[model samples]
Target: MGKDFRAIFWKDIRMLVSGKFFLLAMGALALYTLYVNFGYVRLVELSMYKVCLWDPQGICVDGSLLLQRASSREELDRMLLEDPDGVGIDLSRGKAEFLLYRSTPQVERYLEDYARSLLRPQEDFKAEVLGAFTTEEKQRREITCELLFFELSAVGFLGIAAVLFREKGMGVLRVHACLPVRGRLFLLSKLAVFLLSDLCFAILLTLLNVGVGPGLAILPDVLVETVILSLFMALIGLCCALFLQDFRQFTMIYLVIAVFVATPVFLSANTSVKAGWILFHPFYHLYMGMKNAFFGTPGESFFYYAGAAVGIGLLYMLTAAAFSREMRDAPGGLRYAGKDVEKREEG
Candidate 1:
């Protein structure tokens, strides 16, 4: 059994290598690393909010750097009108008042808190610096980690499925069914290949984008999370490929996964917006796990691992079942011979 599995594994590896899957993945890794290091990290570091202040009687401190002083109330009102989300401060009545165009009430409250915090002097605050990582380093790691997670979970998952479905369509899976080996070995081989690819991608991505010292420090936890997510996504892709008739159907389903499933989890995790049900979403936990790994906070409860184990097991079982069904259904139906058979065959 072990020998057969090794043979199957080697065969899969050969196929993957010949098909240039690794080469393509290498290209993607390079492109993503460049984008994360040069593009995404820079974009995230630029703070978006503009603070416009209107203070009459020169009551406000002149040296305050946070406030962008407006000449008059009319000017402040105009600035606020132009950028409704821009924070506004009015000091017309000898005391400062915060003004904002109300969009989401939650966001309005958040802006108020932010405005107040900005107005305070640095000497008044005694916040601890948790790590020596600079803002740029932190941003690099955060976005690099996110990009790696996305590449493995979604892009790599789809790539593996596309390759597998091509073989399935070519009736190659049926040939595997007749071989003197466990079908599970065949499935395992593909998973092993993709998992290794994803892990290597993660390593390179972290090193290139997050710099060597900090990236190496967090490598173990990052790899742990990468393995977990890669296995889960590979199984999912396998399950989908085994069940779906063709790439067209898989593409449709993948679209749903990309938009409705992954987008909200990303938004809620990275942004101020919080969704109540994200606690139950598996990807949300994985996303947080990756994020935490980047920040050197890998601690999570036992339930996280337990849930991941359960999910991976369930997906593997489903994929196996689907593979069996596909094997049974390959030569689905037959018909009698005639001109009718010829016409029917043409149709």
Candidate 2:
């Protein structure tokens, strides 16, 4: 069993190399690191909200550096009209008045709180420290977590499926059926290869974006989460590839997974686009786990691990059953006459 596993593992690794999966991962690592360092981190570090002020009477002190003085009320109105997202302050009266375009009552309330907070920068307000990580560290962890989630859920998931489709196209699965190795182990080898690749990516991504010190500190937990997500995604990839007719079908399914499935996971996780049901989204939990690990926080509660374990077990069982069925249906590439595709000759 050990030898068989090793052989299959090495074969899968070679296949991955042949497919240039490693090169793609390296490219993704560099792109993500560059974006984090040069683009995303800097974009996040910029001012939270642009404040346009029309305070002619000097009623409000210029507490925020982001606050820009408008020449008159007409100017402030024009600015608000041009940039509806920009919060406008009309303090022509002695009392400071916050003006904003009509929006949801909840959003309006949030904008009001934000605008008030900006106006009182010198107030002695103490923030409850959630973790030892600084603002920049938090931002790094955030973008890193999001990118890692995307890599596994979309890229890595499709990678395994694509590899399997190639084997199917070449009819290699037909040969594997008669091999001494158990069908599950055959699947396991592929899963192991993908899991290993994803783990290495996780390590480098954390270190590169989150910095060495913080990344190393949370490496263990991050790896645990990575293993969980990797296994689930790889198995799912196998299931889809084995069952789906061809790559064309898989492409459509891939669209659903990447766009529809992952879209809400990101929107609900990052922004205030509240969806009450995200509490039950598995990817949300996984994403949060990755994010928490980067920030040196514990996200693996009993429920979290329990759900992950159950999910992995279920997916493995399903993949094994599907794989066995696939092998039993066609044990060899040999077929007689036009009934089977394997035995046709003289083409």
Candidate 3:
């Protein structure tokens, strides 16, 4: 059994290598590391929004050093027109009137407070830190968590499916139907391979982006969450590939999942957008679990792990049933699903 599993593992690894899975993973890791360390953090630091003022009567005495002065009301209008995100100050009525684009309530409140603070710098507002991370650590953990979620949900899902689809195209999976190894092992082997790859990706990504000591401190818990997420996503990819007709349909379905399903999870998790249903969104918990693991605060409730296990089990069973059906109903005299694809393509 062990030997059979190892053979499948090696075979899948070769397939993944030919598919350039490892290369893609490395490229993504390097790209994300560079982006978090060099780009995103600095961008956050400079997010003190540009304040534009058109105060002809000089009703506002204290102007901020960060403020950009405007000569006329038209100039202020032009600034706000060109950069709607920039806060505009209109003092034509002898009082500072803020003109800015409509945003979320939280953002609007922040912008209004910021504009008022700039006009009166002596009115200092103090804040108390609730969390213990430095800015760099917070950003590192944040970006790392998001990248891991993306890799597992998007990249890792595609990688496993691509390998399985290759097997399906070449009729290799059909051959496995006649093999002595258990049917589940075939699926398990692919999951195992991708799981290892994702875990490796998680480790290096954490270390490179979040600093060695901090990342290592949380590595064990991170790997635990990684395993849960990898299994869940790999099972989903397997079921999707097994049940979907072809890569074209798979592409459409993936877009639905990636854009619609995943986007809201990101928005609700990272932003202040409150959704009453986010608590029921499974991926949101998975994302938060990975994030908490990175921060050494595993906030996974009882329902998260339980729900994850049930989901994985259901997906696995569905994939197994679909796998059996595909084998049993393979086109007559043809070994694989895509044996006649070339003829169809030519037509």
Candidate 4:
């Protein structure tokens, strides 16, 4: 069993190499690392809201350095005009009055609060710090987690499906039915190959973007989440490839999963966008599980792990059924039969 599994595993590795799966994964890693280090972190830095003050009598003292002084009322108006988002203070009458371009009530309230915080910088208006991560480190981890989720859910899914589709196209699966190896070994081999690839990817992605020391501390949890997600997605891809008639059908389903299904999870998790329905979405929990792992806060619920284990088991059974059906119904069976006839005639 071990020898046969090893052979099947190496065969799948060769198939992946021929399809450039490793190369594409390395390319994705490079692209994500570059974006995190050079683009996302710099662009997402927390810039304070611009606050313009026109204190003609200089009544306000010890204001935050974030405040921009407006020499006159006209200059303050001009500043607010140039920067529509900027909050202006008209202290010319010796009493503070907030001024700004009209906006939604919620935004106006937030702008007022921000301006007030600047006025009283000495007060503890900031939210309590939870972790010791710096602003840049936080941004790095956030984007890294997002990228890793995308890679596992979308890219890894596609990779496995593509490999299986290629094998199907080349009549390799039909040939497997006549081999001495058990059918389940074929499925397990593919799962093992992709699972290992994904784990390696998760490790490198974490260590490279999240820093070696910090990423190492959280890697065990992260890899645990990675294993669950990787196996689930690979089995899904396998079942899809086996059951669908062709790549075109699979592409349509893939788009629906990647766009409609995954989009809501991202919005609800990353942005302030809220949806009560998202709580029931399985992928949302999977994404959050991976995210919490990166942040060093693994989910403590036994039910979550139990549900994941049950889900994977069901998917494996479904994949095995699909594999058997495909093998029995494949057109390659006839071609192999004809080859057998030719060999018998030569004998």
Candidate 5:
């Protein structure tokens, strides 16, 4: 049994490598690293929102460096008209008034606080550092965590499905049914291959983006959560491969998942956006777990680990059922009649 499993495992690895899976993985690693260091981090560092002030009477005393000084009220109005996204303050009357193209409650709160931060009593306000990480470290951890999640949940999942669907289309999976190997070995082999690939991707992503010292400190927790997510996603991909008839159908479903399902989770977890029901979304917590792990703030909840185990178990069972069904139905269908000729001849 061990030998058969090993043979099947290596075969899948060879197939994956031959298909340039490793090359794609390396390309993704390099691209993601460049994006994090050269693109995302720079954007985060330069997020100081532009503000225009029209305080002709000198009513405002806020010393916020983010505030842009206007020589005259006319100049401020002209600037605000030119840049709609810029926050504008008008002090025409004795009382100060805020002006902008639009305002959300969140944006209003930010503007009001920012205005207050520039006031003379700066001691009354305090800017707290949320974590031990500096600005650069925070940026590194946030982008690295998000990229790791995307690679494992979406990209890595699709890669495995693409590979399996190739075998399925070529009728190779049906041939495995007749070999003296355990049926589950095929499913297990794919899972193992994808799990290893995902873990390697996570490590490289963390190290390249977060710096080796910090990444190593949190790698164990990150890898634990990664393995759980990877296994679950791999099984899902396998299930999709077995059940979905074509790549086009699978691509549609993948699109829905990567967009609607994953987008809300990212919004709720990373940004200030809050949804009351987000706690029910499994990936939300998983994403939080990863973010926390990246910042060396791993969640100690037993429910997280337990839920992951249960999720992985259920997904594996579903994939196994689908796999077995595929094998069973393959030999009896007209589509498989030509391929089953050898099976009948052997019988």
Candidate 6:
């Protein structure tokens, strides 16, 4: 069993190489690392909310360096007009008055608090230190988590499917049925290869973007989530490749999953867009599981792990069934090849 599995694993690796899957993965890694290091980190460092102060009386003393001084109330209005998200403070009324386009009550309150905090820079307001991550470290972990989730969910999903489709075209799966190996072993080999590839990716991505120490601290939890998500996506890709008539059909399914399924999860998780239905979405939990792991707060719920285990088990069974069907429906030439092997053995 071990020997057969090893052979199949090596064969799958070669097939992936021929398809240039690893090259594409490496390219994605490079792109993500560059964006995180050069683009995202710097961009996030730009002030979250630009505070424009229009205090002509100079009543405010020792204000935060973050404040953008406005010569006149009109200039403050113009600044807010240019950047609608910017917070504007008008002290023309002798008392500080907050002015901005109205947003949600929660957001308005947050902006007001932030602006008020800036006014009293000299006050020593001691706040409890919850986590050790600095602003830059937190941003790095955030973008890294997002990129890793995308890599596993979308890129890894496509890689396995593409490899499987190539094998289907080459009639490799047909020969598997004729060989003296369990049908599950072929699927297992593919899963093993892709799983390891994804885990390595997670490690590198985390280490590169989140720093060596912080990334290492969270790697164990991150890897656990990666394993579950990797296996889940790989099995889904395998089932799709096996059951779909052709790559064109698979492309349509891929688009549907990428657009409808994954997009909603991302929006609901990352953006202010909240959907009541997102809680029921399985991928959302998977995404959050990964995000939480990056933050070093793995979900402690037994049900989450249990459900993931069940889902993976069910997917594996489904993939195994699909593989058996594909092998049974092999082309006549492959059937002939199998017969020749049997005849040679009998002789």
lDDT of 3 by residue, 1-347 (tens): 99999998898899989989899899999999889989988777634577898888877776667778899988988888887888998888887788886467767878877887787776673223458998778888888899889989998988887777767777766677787888878888998899989989999998988889988999999999999999999988988888876677889989999999999999998987868998888888888888889889997888778888888888889999988887766432253444577667889
Off by over 4 Å in 1: 42-45, 81-84, 122-132, 331-347
RMSD list, candidates in order: 4.2, 3.7, 4.6, 4.8, 4.4, 5.4
**Which 10-residue window in model 4 sums to the lowest lDDT?**
120-129
Candidate 1 accuracy as lDDT: 0.82
Give the candidate number with the greatest lDDT.
Answer: 4
lDDT of each: 0.82, 0.83, 0.84, 0.89, 0.82, 0.87
TM-score ranking of the models: 1, 2, 6, 5, 4, 3
Tens digits of per-residue lDDT, candidate 4, 12-123, equal: 9999998999999999999999888888887766765689999989887978888899999899999999888789988889887999785656478778877877876778
Q: Point out the worst 10-residue segment of candidate 6 by lDDT.
A: 121-130
Error of 1 at 141 (Å): 1.9
Model 5 lDDT tens row, 316-338: 89889988888876632444456
lDDT value, residue 7 of candidate 1: 90
lDDT, candidate 2, at 188: 85
For model 3 the local lDDT of residue 247 reads 73
Clash count, candidate 5: 4
- Candidate 6: tens digits of C-alpha lDDT, residues 1-347: 99999999998899889888889889999999999999999876645788899999998878888889999988899999999887899988888899876466547877887787787766753223468888888889889999998899888998899888777766777877888999888999999999999999999999989999888999999999999999999999999998887788989999999999999999988877778999999999999999899999886489899999999999999998888999998543454467768889999
- True-structure RMSD for candidate 5: 4.4
Model 4 CA deviation exceeding 4 Å by range? 42-44, 51-63, 67-116, 121-126, 331-347
lDDT of 6: 0.87
Q: Candidate 3: which stretches are off by over 4 Å? A: 43-102, 106-126, 332-347
TM-scores for all candidates? Answer: 0.87, 0.84, 0.78, 0.82, 0.83, 0.84
The pairs that clash in candidate 1 are none
Off by over 4 Å in 6: 53-73, 90-97, 102-106, 119-130, 331-347
Estimate the TM-score for candidate 1. Answer: 0.87
